[model samples]
Target: MEEQLRELGLEFTKEVREDFVNFRADPLAVVYPRSEEDVIKLVNFAREKKIPIVPWGAGTSLTGAVACKGCILVDMRYMSSILEINEVDWYARVQPGVNLGKLNEELSKRGFFFPPDPASFFLCTVGGAVANSSGGMRGVRYGTFREWVLALRVVLSSGEVIRVGEPLRKNRAGYDLVHLFVGSEGTLGIITEVWLRIIPTPRQRLVALVGYVSSLDSVAGIIIDMRRSGILPEIAEYVDDEVIRALNEHLNAGLRKSGGGILLLRVDEPDSERMREILRRWGVEAEVLNDEEWERMYSLRSQSALALKASAESMYVEDIVVPVSRLVEAVRRLRDLERKYNVRMPVIAHIGDGNLHPNILLERSEDADKIFDEVARLAVELGGSVSGEHGIGIQKAKVMGEQITSHSGKRVLEIMNGIKRLIDPESIMNPGKYVELAYEINRSEERRSSS
Candidate 1:
């Protein structure tokens, strides 16, 4: 297999060891295909050999999505390219390996932008974003990658190049395979290219940092009321007081100097008049800032990992998501975990979408593994998902069982395995991620005995 990969003029390097959420996995081979043809050749070769191939972007995934144990790791970063941008349709065709930040910069020149801005947008690749079906601050309004992706050119495990969806605005298609592959992690197939839906740049923008003297429930109530009144914000976020303080101490920047608990808000529209009225109706007492301040606030919200790393001895973020109505309870339960576990649980949330990144900062004395375990369990108990944005990488694989019911969980596993079998039946693509063939059997047997 390695010889065939090299023969195809693809770069095949020795094994590259990696870890996601502490789930360690090492690949037998790492292949970098410089072009789509290279990808096809490698896929066909792997299929013939019955070897699994895992498609990887920038490897910024917090979930076990990218971690592979003893399989072919196909790094898609080399495939980065902005193939074409259609000004007429306000869409762009890009190779999956293109960086989100880089792509946006190119789009900016043409007066368009992709709305899905994950925290790691600068580092994450578009293909990886699609694989995880990632979402971010703007997700409350724009939703996730699912909404932004218009068309896809994918190479199934069978070495068949299939085009799923199209650049059209609407379609009454049979089955939406585009969406299925979006969040399928790496279990489905390798994504070669993507046609992304782009939006016109907002003409007006406003940001507000609101301080609440009351509990999280009060802040949540404000959001509920705002939603009921039909005020859809472009971006709405929450940062616990503890998290704000940690950021201040970490960056030595006085961000914590302001609010009691903080709600960072950003609104955009072609008309600022409507925005101002909406803000007023929400009864939010916030200090409105211009574009400059708005950019600074966005920097603070998305660049949280830098602050977290600087402030804590060690840290891992818990990206838990629940329904909008369940967000308040989820936050309260997280606070309880903070006290019970004796760890620094600084909470920040995309409140509009009810997704929380409850970052756990740990010291040398604290058991990081135990703390993560408890947090994962809590995510399930609250009617929330184990991961909001980050896919189930190695970090959350163990707790994955808890997220789904036994019957439903087993069914998902079976479908994933079946799809894998149909694609790269040789089991060579992204070996251990999402659905691992070897582990599938073991887990199914375990489920039977437990029942």
Candidate 2:
């Protein structure tokens, strides 16, 4: 296989490595594709040999989506390029390997910016973000990569190139296939280029409000109240006391250890006062941050996961979301689960939108999988999703199967599986992950129950 790859004049590596989430990948070879032609060639070769192919973009995935054994890792690093930034069209088209932070910097020069600022935006790729439909702090206001992506140029499993969507706002197309591939996690195809919607920079300055709550109970109540008051913040993030401690110990964040937790809210200049009023009404000691202080605070929250990872031997970051109305009850149940499991599940949330990431600290990974499933199940039971932004890779596949069956019905899963088959009939593109894994688990359970 290495010789065959080299014959095609592609840069190839025989080594495999683990992703950020600690999932190991043992690829037959890692091939770097500098162009769409290279990707097509690699795909054709892999298809001919019946070899699995997984796309790699910065390896910032929290799930095991990129992990493959004896497969081909199509490293898109060399394809990094900002192809076009249409100022008039309000879109930026770029290669899969373009760094997200760099893209934002370019957009900023034009008085525009991409809104989906994932925590790893500085290090992750635009392609990776689009693939995972990853969300971040601004997600509370701007939504996820799923919403920002206007179109994508993807190479299917059969080595055929296709563009999913137009770069325009209003397009009554055949179907919303753009969304189907947005969060597909590379299971369906390889994203070669992306066209993401951009917006002119907001003229109104946003004010940051830090509310020190006494407990998760207080934080939950505040979120519920904020929604009731109709005070939508640009960014409503939460970092628990334990997470604060981790940040301070690891990154010297020096954040105050509040009794409840810290609610970092950023709203437009006009709504700042109302946000403060809501904080005080919820018994939270609120203080507005200066411009400089706000930047540091946002950076600290963004680094919370890294801090937690450093503090623990192993970490399973849980991404679950309940309805806004069920936020309080969800928090209470999460607290109960923490006590029941006897683990330090330090939470960080996009609270305004009900997305919670409780970093579960463990000495060993033996229990991580079990706990991951448990938390995901709780989200489903609470009338929420098992995954809000992070796609369901191997780690959360069984729970995803359960969620789909219980909520969207078994037929929905079948339909999703059918789409996967429709796109990648050979099943060589990131096989045994995402929807495919969940469907596999469901089918196995069906077989067992029928027996």
Candidate 3:
């Protein structure tokens, strides 16, 4: 396999060592592919040998999605390339490994920008974003990764070059295959290239932070009211006191200590005067923030993840999304959960979309593990999922059965397994990460016997 991969211009080194996970000596070999052809050959070889081929990005994934049990890890960074830019259609065709920050920097010069800005935008690859269907703080208005991705050049498990979807706005074809591959999590195929939809940059913008003394429920209610009043900010985010404290301590920002929570919002328009008036109407007490200050605020959101990781010996990040109407109840419940679990829970969320990231900080103590388990269980009972942006990966695989209650869950698994079988019958591509080979085979057998 190594020789075949190398023959196709790929580079790899085999080492019996622990990758990413230092606590547990996880076994895996990391391989970097140089080109699309190299990825194709590697996939084919993995399929032939039934060896798992896990697609690796920036290793920013908190979930065990990229973690493998002695499988071949294919890193796509080396294949980073922006293949084409279609000015006529306003689309850019790029390799899956393209750095999102770099791509956006280039796009900004062209008077366009990609909207799906993940927290790890600087390091995460487009392939990683597409694979996980990632969304950022701006997702409240911009939507998720699935929204921007128009077309994909993916290599199936069987080493076939198949193009799915088109750059056009509408497509009512037989099936929407492109979306199916969006959040597949490397369980279906390897994405080599993507044709993303870009939009013209906004002329001017205003960002402000609001410190609310009332409960999150009150804030959520106010947000709904504002929305109903036709005040649509480009971004509306919420941060809990713990996260605010961390930011203040981490960055030494002399932020107010009185506010129980913080709401960061941004408005972008051609006329900054109108935007400022709109904000003032919302009682923001608007203070115009400079670019550095705005970035400091945004970085505080991104840095919260790193802070959580650093503060604790071990931690669990929860991506729980609920109905917009239930936003207050959701936030209130999280605070209660923190008290009940006796853990420090820092939250940063896209409140407009009702997506809250309630991160539980835990030390590497035996007592911490028990608390972590209980909190994980409580997260689902509160009408929220275990994961929102960070994928199930291996960390939350056990919790999969909890999310999909009815045949809907079983049906989803079946479909995923069917796609896997159709693409790679030998069960090689990222084996054990998603649906198992037996699961699909059993379903097929049941259908055959029934027929």
Candidate 4:
């Protein structure tokens, strides 16, 4: 196998290892391919050898999608390039390896910007974001990478390269196959190039309203009131006093501790008076900040995950979504877990959209699963998904199995498994994770019941 791979003339490193969460990619050979043709060649080799192939980006995957024991890990770093940015067409076509922040910076220079800005934007790759279908602070107005991706050029499991969709805004030429690859998590195929939809920079001078609420209940109340009034924010985020304390201690971010919680908001349209009225009714202290203060607040919000991680070596980052109506209930459930477990679960949320990340700080690594399950179960019971942005790798596969089976039919999982079979017939494309793993869990349950 080494002899054959070495003969391909692509840059190869033996026994390359990459780690994240619980998944480790200790590949037999890590190959760096500089272009689509090179990726095709490697893919062909993997197929012929019946070896698994995992495409890697910046390795920012919170899930275990990138975990490979002996698969051929294809690192796309060498292929990073911004091929074109057409302002008129409103699309930026680039190689999958381009850093997301770099791509946005280039777009911004041309008076346009890509909307999906993940917290890992500084470190993550456009390809990784696309595969995860990642959402961010701007997600309330802009949505995730799934919505921004106009088209993709992918190398199929069979080593066949095909381009799906177009750079144009309106094209109904075929089935929506573009979306199928958006969040496939490198399972379907290796994404070679990406055509992302772009938008002109907003002309409006947006200001932020930082609400220091008396409690999380009040925070939830403000969000519900804002929604009820038909006011849409560019971003609506909430972080409890615990996360604020973490930021101050670890990041040296001098932020006021909102005794109950802090609600950070930005508006495309100015309506601070109305927002103040809502906050005033809840007896919350508020301030509409200048750009400098707002920028600091925004940066603090983005660094929240890192701040909380300083407490313990590890944490179970919960990415659960509840209905907007059930936001208060979700917050209350988190409070109950803290009291029940006698531990702090610092919450950081994209509150406008109901996606909450309640970091379960672990004293011991083994202790988080039980709490994790309860949180996921809470989302499911409340008619919400187990995950909103963070994709299911190995960590959430069991819950995904239960969620899908209970909400959608068991047949839905079968259809998903069927799609995986259809695309990567050999099951050698990032195998043993994501949807495949979820289905396997259900099948295992069935067998246990029958036995």
Candidate 5:
């Protein structure tokens, strides 16, 4: 493989790589492709050699999505470019390697901005966010990357280049294959270019509300009450006391810590009073902030994971989402797990959407895997997804299989596996993860049951 890659005259390097969550990969060679043509050539060579190919974005993935052994890592950094920002068309055409923050900054100058602001927006690539279908603080109102992506140019495992979906919003020409690859986590194809739907920045006067609650249950109650009262905040986020401590200790963020946690809520000016009334009902006083103060809090929320990382040796960030109705139960279950394991699991959540990120401070603990699986299973039991935004990488494959089998059916898992096989017959494109790994785990369980 090395000789063949050298013969092809590609810019390749041998190195050890690691994702944000410490998932490591030792690739045979990491190839930097400068253009779509370069990606096509590399794909062709990998296909011919039957070597597994993994797409490299900004290395911001929390799951072990990009971790592979002996695989060819297609680093897209060299191809980073903002090709076009069509304000009239309300879309942005960009290379996969473009930094999401940079793209948004450019769009902001034109009075338009992409909505999907993942927590890693400042550090992550647009390709990684699209591939993970990432969600963030704005997810409560704007949705995730899956909703914003309009079209994609992908290089298949057979080295065939194909464009899926159109830049237009109302294209029904075929089966939404654009979405299939959106959160596929580099398992299906290598995305070389992306077209994202852009919208004008909200001009409405917005208010940011900060409050500290008594418990996780109080936070869940507030969200449920807001839902029942028909009050939708622009963004609703929570970071527990432990998370606040981490932020203060690591980032020097002097935050008031309550036994419960801190809640950050943003809403339009018209509904600001209503949001405040709701918080008061919860026995919590909310502080309304100006734009400048809100931006500081927003940045702090985005850096919650990083702050936790600085405080811990190793951390397993579990992205489990339960229905809003069952959030209290989920919190109770989480507390039980913490007590059972005798560990402090700090939480950061997009509470409006029930996407709870329970940071299990691993610290090289052997029982971390068991605790992680238990958290994921709790989501499934409560009729929620194992993963809300972060796709199932190598880490959550087994729990994903269990979720599918329990919620949808065994047939659903089989169909997903079928689609993966149909697309990459040789399993060269980021093989042995996501749907492929989920299907394999399901099959293994079946075999055990039969035995």
Candidate 6:
């Protein structure tokens, strides 16, 4: 493989790589493609040789989505570029390797900005964010990457270059193939270029509030009340006492340790009083923050995962989301799990959306996998998803299958697998994970039942 790639004049290196969560991959070679032509050539070579290919982004995937063995890793760093920013069209066309934060910085100078600010915005690539369909603090107001992506240029497994969707927002041509590839996790094809919808930054005066709550249930209650009262905050997040301690110890966050946790809320200046009144009704004291303080707090919340990672020997980040109505029940069940396992699972949450990330802090015990699956199952039982934004890489594949089968029915899994087969018939594009794995699990269960 090395000799062939060298003969083709492709830039590649042999290396053992690992993702943010330590999911390792030992590829035959990591290739750097500087253009779409290079990607097409590499795909053609891989297809001829029957070699599996995986697209490499910023490697900040918490779900092990980029992990592969004995494959060609397409490193997209050299292709990074902001090709076009059309203010009149309200869109930006960018290469797959463009740093999300850098792109936003450039967009800000033009008086426009992309809205999907994932927690890893500073570290992740636009391609990876689009691939994962990532959501962040602003998701409560702006939605996820899926909502912002307008079009995509993809290189299929057969070396066919195709562009899906258009740069326009209101295009009603054909099926939504753009969305199909948005969060496909590299299973369908490799994205070469992306068109993202951009909008002018809001000019409203916003107020940031921090509420020290008594418990996880209290956080849920506050969010529920705000929702019921028609108070929509731009950002509503929570971090428990253990997470606060971790932040203080590891990141020097200088946060007060409340009895239960802290709730961070941001609202328009006019609605700030209403938001404060809700906190007071819950018997929680609130602190108003200045612009600088709010930015620091937001950065700290984004780095919460890093802080916890430093404090733990091994951490399994569980991205489970329940409905707002079931938020309290989910919290109680999560507490029950912690008590049963006798482990301290510090939680940080996008509370407004019911996306709870319970960081299981423990050594690599035999029960860790069991606890992980149990947490996913709790979300399933509560009529929620196994993953709210994080893609189902190898780690959450089984539970994802369960969630889909139980909620959307087995036929949905079959259809997803069928789509995978249709796009990459040879199963060479990031094979053996996601939809394929889920389908295989379902089929195995069917075999057992028949026997």
Clash totals for all candidate models: 16, 3, 2, 0, 0, 0
Tens digit of per-residue lDDT, candidate 5, span 1-451: 7787777778999999999988998898999999988898899998888889999998988889999998999999988999999988899999999999999899999999888888989989999899999998899998999999999999999888999999998998979999999999999999999999999988988889999899999999999998898888889999999999999999999998889999999998888888899999999999988889989999999999999999998899999889998989999999999999988799999999999999998656799999999999999999999898877899999999999888899999999999999999999999999999989988988899999
What is every candidate's alpha-carbon RMSD to the true fold? Answer: 3.5, 1.0, 4.6, 1.5, 1.0, 0.8
- Writing each residue's lDDT as its tens digit, candidate 4 over 279-384 gives 7889976788899998888888888887887766677788999999999998898889888887668889999998999888877766688888889999998999
Question: Clashes in model 6: which pairs?
Answer: none
Tens digit per residue, CA lDDT, model 3, 53-96? 88887777766677666688888888889987776788889988
Cα misplacement distance, residue 362 of candidate 4 (Å): 1.0
Per-residue CA lDDT of model 1 for 34-151, tens digit only, reads 8878888888887777776788788777765666666778889789889999999878999999999999999999889889999888888999999999998889988899998888
Ordered from best to worst lDDT, the candidate numbers read 6, 5, 2, 4, 1, 3
Q: What is the lDDT of residue 292 in candidate 1?
A: 76
As a whole number from 0 to 100, the lDDT of residue 363 in candidate 2 is 84
In model 1, state the lDDT of residue 345. Answer: 77
| Tens-digit lDDT track of model 2 for 1-451 | 7778889999988887888878888988989999999999999999999999999999888888898898999889999999999999999999999999999999999999899989988889988888999999998889999888888899999999999899999898799989988999999899999999999999988888888888887788888888887878899999889998899999998888877679999888888787788777877758879989998998888888898898888888889988988888888888888888888888999988999998888987777777888888889999999999877888888998899999989999999999999989999999998889999999999999999
Candidate 3: segments with Cα more than 4 A from true spot: 1-9, 15-28, 204-209, 212-214, 268-286, 364-386, 407-409, 435-451
lDDT for model 3, on a 0 to 1 scale? 0.71
lDDT of 2 at 433: 87
The TM-score of candidate 3 is: 0.86
User: For each candidate, what TM-score against the reference?
Assistant: 0.87, 0.98, 0.86, 0.97, 0.98, 0.99
**In terms of TM-score, how similar is model 1 to the real structure?**
0.87
Clash pairs (backbone) in predicted model 5: none
